[model samples]
Target: MDKKKPKKVFVQGAIPPEKIANSIANHQSKTNIGAHSIFLGQIRADEIDGKIVTAIDYSAYEEMAEKVFHEIRESAFSKFDMTCCHIYHSLGKVKTGEICLFVFTSSAHRKVAIEACNYLVEEIKAKVPVFGKEIFEDRTHQWKVNK
Candidate 1:
């Protein structure tokens, strides 16, 4: 097996929808893969105490976050019998309805790709050192909680 080096996961801001499509297009030449699974995390306009959220400003302990992301990638590679995987996350202000995270996995069949995609999402949520500050419509903000 040809194991590749770890890739940088953080983007300056929100991930673009075109990036997602281009990623899939990039893999079209790899004929050995028959299935691909993707997971996209979008910011939500949540209501709290009558304030409506407008966007989220994400922050991370960059060094630690990158290290953790590498670890998660390694773990997924080891655990899943898959062809490839890619992960990208936002590092700055991402408005509601914008994409923040994107994970893509490919395999010879549907099961491995789907399972690996799910695994990566769960691991990223539980293990990454990323934080989000919810910005409300009136410019008020608060820390976000994953639930």
Candidate 2:
């Protein structure tokens, strides 16, 4: 993978399982990679104020978000000895139990891969401009705050 090029990090809706599977498959050819770490962020149906969250509608300032994503990727590469890193985030409605974010990192050792993946996830949550609206089952909604 070309680390210098910016990848399209946002997906239109919930990320499909096949895309994740394909990513893993694609990395099989890289014989030097000894460890791979993956993080999947799934939407949860949480009861808040007696209402159940049915989904999260996500949105972002695309241009700015992409810039942040690139910076996160670069930072991860510089901080850890990662062979490759990829991140995908959902942009539209993602239902409870659906995947909203995916982060994959690979390296020659387990520690580096794991640390890079965790770093990417934390940086994204802390720095990205993405917003999420929690949609309740009864049609009510509230803006989500990262915790």
Cα lDDT for residue 56, model 2? 100
Winning candidate number (lDDT): 2
Candidate 2 Cα outliers beyond 4 Å, as residue runs = 1-3
Tens-digit lDDT track of model 1 for 1-147: 335666899998889989999999999999999999999999999899999999999999988998888889889889998898999999999999999999999999999999999999999999898999999999989999987
Per-candidate clashes, comma-separated: 0, 0
What RMSD does each model have against the real structure?
1.5, 1.8
User: Using TM-score as the measure, which candidate wins?
Assistant: 2
Error of 1 at 135 (Å): 0.2
Model 1 TM-score on a 0 to 1 scale: 0.96
**How do the predictions measure up, each by TM-score?**
0.96, 0.97
lDDT of candidates 1 onward, in order: 0.93, 0.95
